[model samples]
Target: MLSQLTYLSFLAVFAGIPLSILVMGSVISRRGDHQPVRVQVGGVALMITLALGYTIPWDSYLIARGVWWYGEGVVTTRLWWMPLGEYLFIVAQTVLVSVWTFQYASVADPTVGHSWRDRLLGVVAGVAVGAVGVGLLLGPAETFYLGAILAWAGPVFALQWGVGLRYLLAIRRRIVVLVGVPVVYLSSIDRIAIAQGLWTISPTYSTGLTVGGLPIEEGLFFLVTSLFIVQALVLLRWVIARWG
Candidate 1:
């Protein structure tokens, strides 16, 4: 059974520790950085706001629809249909990714031009993914979780890609590191949470697929959300550079 303490402990261990270390490192290494602390903080704050606004309603719907649920005593309170802890998770995850993004943000020079070909290719790919998700959503109950994730995230993916796909690709290695580390770490923790009955992904709504005991849908959820944060931050930096 999941207690509120267990949930908070997970956040403390997985998110809190890394965030503390990163902040300390930034404070110590603040010399000669392209972005000032104020700018970095402002960018992160903006991303966090966007993340919460975009995610809360979708997550609430997921809980209400029985796509997932928490263990007994796992959450002590609710905001709309989500636990308070869940909201904190959203903020923590956003900050983690956004901070990591700034750490590696110096690698890419965003002034270089991008071709229309790349933009079209990315948009088409996003549309295709969304189409597949829509099909799954209409097919059967088992794919609802996966479908909802893709359907919700695909358009955002397309928009980001259309705006700055080439720029992102130029900084692909940095983006990979920033996005991959947290996604892998958080997904691992999420796997443990599910295994320990901290929360349950509804079998009826999810495809019966697992990656080393973690649901595939859960993995995809983390992956896309992390990507969203990284993409937005990287592009925002680019915009500021080009026109700020």
Candidate 2:
């Protein structure tokens, strides 16, 4: 019955359940820090809005191109080219990472000051990754999915780096914990969903590569998206600290 769960129900179980628990825990833990909580909550709201706005169009385009598709009876409704469940996923994932990031932000002392060298390094690295993605886009067809993920995510990574590479580096360990846990956990669930026939990735668009039966592209997809959410929340907190 678990594998038989509809796509929406699957998210309700995996994403919704954990989100409710984490949100309650975050609120209880931060109850004493009212101002910071307000700021973080505001930041999370903004990130959620931005995540939905940014992801919907891109995901719809991918679906239209047959990069991926949902299984029969797994989805009950469609919005444009995406299943409604996919939209919920965008919101759920952003909030999940935002709440998790707050756990670190509440206790960690802010890293002050910035360096042009660090900023430049971050920009160069982001651009380099984007370049690689562009190259893959022009190469064999199988690399297209990976290429699209990198290309879509690279510029945002650069922008975040440009704003707070120094700060991000200072809190590197926290970043790892914030981004890593979600990516691995979500990737595992994603593997399960694929196994259950909830959705199928087009072999024509994806690299025919697997990590423990999960596609490498799927892992990278979660990796970059998690990084985007975590980095945004951390930087937003940093900005509020400096200017708010």
Candidate 3:
């Protein structure tokens, strides 16, 4: 029998690819919608690249510190102590999210706007989050998992908002509807994976807090990750339209 991680690895790809295809189908099927093919492709590519760049190092550190651990033999391969499934996860999740967000944008709120003040606050908030994440890393916090999640996630989220808040906020409703559906679905899947021992979180590095068997940090991880992708998609639409 395949280990749970192996099972999950297959599931992750299966889920991610079809869902992305579904989103693309939705995008192309919509009447009167103009798809920005080049920009969408480029933006999603960047999102995947950046997502891996961040998650790989962060996850490796967390695993090394016992913040969480993947079950032994769950993966058939490992890269620097992180599972191959994880690397695929970065790509799969981003594709699913990027396609869905842009699809929703085409259907519901198709215009992008700008706001200088939101931009300013976004930069300031990103800086603050970075500062706080560093402090948490250096602080005497009994568990660093929360800090670590927030440190990276917070700044990335804030910076994306800073540059793209106007566009994001314009379609905030679509964002909420689109992003919420997946977060709930994925978080539930994640909860099951954790429960099944696909991965383990160390209580020593966590607050022992959980929601419906999912840790608060895990929940935030999904939320921020979705938001980051959404913002990036919106910003790409805005920039590509403006300058492309």
At residue 39, give the lDDT of candidate 2: 73
Question: Alpha carbon lDDT of residue 70, candidate 1?
Answer: 85
Residue 86 in candidate 3 has what lDDT?
Answer: 76
What 10-residue stretch in candidate 2 is worst by lDDT? 102-111
lDDT of 1 by residue, 86-147 (tens): 99999999998888778866644756667799889779878887888898888899999999
Pick the winner on TM-score between candidates 2 and 3: 2
TM-score of each: 0.92, 0.93, 0.85
Off by over 4 Å in 2: 31-35, 106-111
Output the number of the TM-score-best candidate: 2
lDDT of 3: 0.74
For candidate 3, lDDT tens digit of each residue in 1-244?
Answer: 2344463465655566678677768757873257557766787788888888878888887877778777766777777877778777777788888777766665323356557988897778777877777777777554477778778876786778787766776777777887797788778878877877878878877778899989887887888788788777766666766666
RMSD of 3: 3.0
lDDT of each: 0.85, 0.85, 0.74
Residue 130 in model 2: lDDT = 87
Greater TM-score among 1 and 3 belongs to: 1
Q: State how far residue 93 of model 3 sits from its true place (Å).
A: 0.8
The 10-residue segment of model 1 with minimum total lDDT is 1-10
